[model samples]
Target: MADIAQTRAAPLRHSTAGALAGLSLAMLVSSLGTSIANVALPTLSAAFAASFPAVQWVVLAYLLAITALIVSVGRLGDVVGRRLLLIAGLTLFSAASFAAALAPSLAMLIAARAVQGLGAAVMMALTIALVGETVPKQRTGSAMGLLGTMSAIGTALGPSLGGVLIAALGWRSIFLINAALGAVALLAAWRFLPGDKGSGIDRAEAKGAARFDMLGTLLLAATLAAYALAMTMGRGHFGGLNMALLGGAIVGAALFVVAEAKVASPLVKLALLLRDPVLAPSLAMNALVSTVMMATLVVGPFFLSRALGLGDAATGAVMSIGPVVSAFCGIIAGRVVDRLGAAAMIMAGLVLMVAGCVALAVLPGVFGVVGYVAAIILLTPGYQLFQAANNTAVMADVDSSERGVVSGMLSLSRNLGLVTGTAVMGAVFAFAVGTKDVATAAPVAVAGGMVFTFAAATGLVALAVAIAVAGRRGRIA
Candidate 1:
């Protein structure tokens, strides 16, 4: 195996700082795009004279495109050059954003969003891989932390920024803003990013001209698309179509596994995933923790609005605290992880998350807003720490040559967690409250449902804690 540690060049012409800045900007743009369009759904429905289901596709289409294409694009980056792919993705993303802004019809806008998703997928798949290639081994944790910070900030700001832009300049302004940001990112990437001449594995792969695993790639994409569709459509009802999609996803996944094992150069190295002691556990922990965290995000707003009788503005204000805390904590987590190692940080983070869930479950009605704020503070930093540290741990063991696919797997875990969290938690809330939507349920029902939800989330966190504990004997890196 080619050792990534031995293969990395000293540093790029612009150094680690410049590369980080460019990558961070790219990550921010991609993260922002994920949730920014959500605020415009109602407005889009009115403008296009479309029904709710049609307008909802504006969000669903983007998400599905990203989920389906991310892994394949990541593998492509490893074959070509990461820097080259980043530049191309940034340019394509910026152009797509421009097209979206200028869209004359809803269909055009949706198409533009799909293209944007593809571009975003490329960028997302490469961010960690590029960082691994650029940053020194000793400081990888810090770089991952900074990247996580930017992602948190972008995700936190997306909805608020979208609302503000839509209010000031209309929904098109959101894409216009993304275009401007994407342009800046593109310029920075072009100026700061080094060529892949330094990456021996990329060069070797190019020379060998290995056949791309089209069969495995297609199976993986189909599996993810079917799974995402099942989860998205299965929210309200587990009807025949949802069941069919779910079955298709299972079949596709099983086929993908078999195809990957036989392919000369598989889209995903199933053997690596199973054999790597650190990487597999870290990925599993990330997925589980993300599931718990996203469940909170999905239900917290409802708890604030219905149970506590808070308005949109107040709820938004309260909700902003978590991301704000997370951003700052991410910055701090890097240095701490560098000193204490990822396992320590992960263990601490899991403890905090479990505590926060317990607080939310038990103290919300009793302590009121204070308890909610406390829970947010705990969960925010907890998640930030876990994300930055766990990423560092995952990358530590991966060969530089394999970073692309590994990074894609990490990203896939998070996306899967989000989809699963929303579907499962929503179902749990519905079952608890005897309603399809918790938002419309009575205050008492909402409160009871939230408690039940948080209690369930706490159990998930406890499982994560057990994983962290079992893996704690070894050093993270």
Candidate 2:
């Protein structure tokens, strides 16, 4: 078997710049799609003459599909080839975008968006995997930082871009624009990315590709779908259905564990997740930090608009401060991680997040926009630093043949964090405000809720710090 040292010496097929550009473009487009659709919700509701709950399915469907399929798709990329999977994914995404733009009914549009989500999942799972393959070990941190920056930019621009496009060219224009951008990304990927023929996976593993664990894949998909449904709908009506779905998720998880242990080729490597010291802790930190980051993103806009008396434009501007800081800080973090190693950066990031959350919780009203901006400055850079360093650490010990599945695992952790954070934080905010409808709540109520929710979020970040510290102690012992 080829060892980590041997794999590290494997020559990349493309220049670092070329590979980074191709992969970063893919990352940007996928990340952009996640939030771009949000701005069009009102427009879509009007166009479909659908209720708000029904229209929300357009977004929910996409997120659910991506979350459910990302792991399976990443595993597939490992067996087949990441390059091939990425090309196929980009093509599918573009085609879906076009279909969505042309859809005459809400149902069709939702279906198209779901397909688009599948494509995005493929891209998301492979973005870091491909980067790991293409860049040398010494430069992996910087490359990850670049990818992180692109994601920040994409997310930061999504709402503003969507609003502009919707006003100027209508809601369909958003998808249409994505279709065009996707086409360009596809071409660049094809032209720049290395072919699958000599990609990083070991020859022996490729030979065993036919032994793919279909049952494990299905179980994982079912688990993720059930969990996502439970979380998304649990806060609303249908308590009975939510309970059933949660129960199904628990069953699916147990069955998946059994199936993985027996399968010749498991969809996810149970040992890596459960026993590998390095990977286990890194993944845990990833999920926890992601939760903190996501919670802030979910709650930030509400605080700005309600508590700060900002309009849409000002709220957007204030909200963008984090991503903008992240863009520059991500680059710096990459280099820092490469020099100082991932552990220090990860610890520093968690500390910053804890401090930032505390500041936001305590100082929001006292310092006003300055406090919000200050908190964001700390939080965004902390997130970027943690992500770049943690990703490097996770992939550092993974075998080349296992990069695909491991990458999938990493992406899955992030998706889980995002969903969990959004649900939990929103619930906390709703509870604090004493109403499910926060948007309609009084400004004073919203301000109070913001403080309480941010304080709760601070506790979550503190927990992440504890986990990181425990992981470090375990490693030292």
Q: How many backbone clashes are present in model 1?
A: 0
Q: 443 in model 2: Cα distance from truth in Å?
A: 4.2
Tens digits of per-residue lDDT, candidate 2, 1-477, equal 579887766544456577678899888998899889988999999998998888888888889988999889988887778888999999999999999999999999999999999999998999889987678899889988898998888888888899999999999999998899888889878777876666434642565655667898889999999999987874443478888999999999999999899887778778767867678777777777777777677778777888788998898788778878987888899998999998888888888888888888877778998988887887788888889988988888787667777888888888898887777778788899888777788888888888898788778777877877888888888
For model 2, the stretches where C-alpha displacement exceeds 4 angstroms are 1-13, 197-209, 234-238, 440-445
State how far residue 162 of model 1 sits from its true place (Å).
1.4
**Decoy 1 TM-score against native:** 0.93
lDDT of 2: 0.84
Q: Per-prediction TM-score, please?
A: 0.93, 0.92
Model 2 / residue 196 / CA error / Å: 2.8
Poorly placed runs, candidate 1 (over 4 Å): 1-12, 198-209, 473-477
Which 10-residue window in model 2 sums to the lowest lDDT? 199-208
**Tens-digit lDDT track of model 1 for 121-204:** 988889988987778888888988898898888988899899999999999999999999999999888777767764545464
Judged by whole-model lDDT over C-alpha atoms, candidate 1 comes out at: 0.85
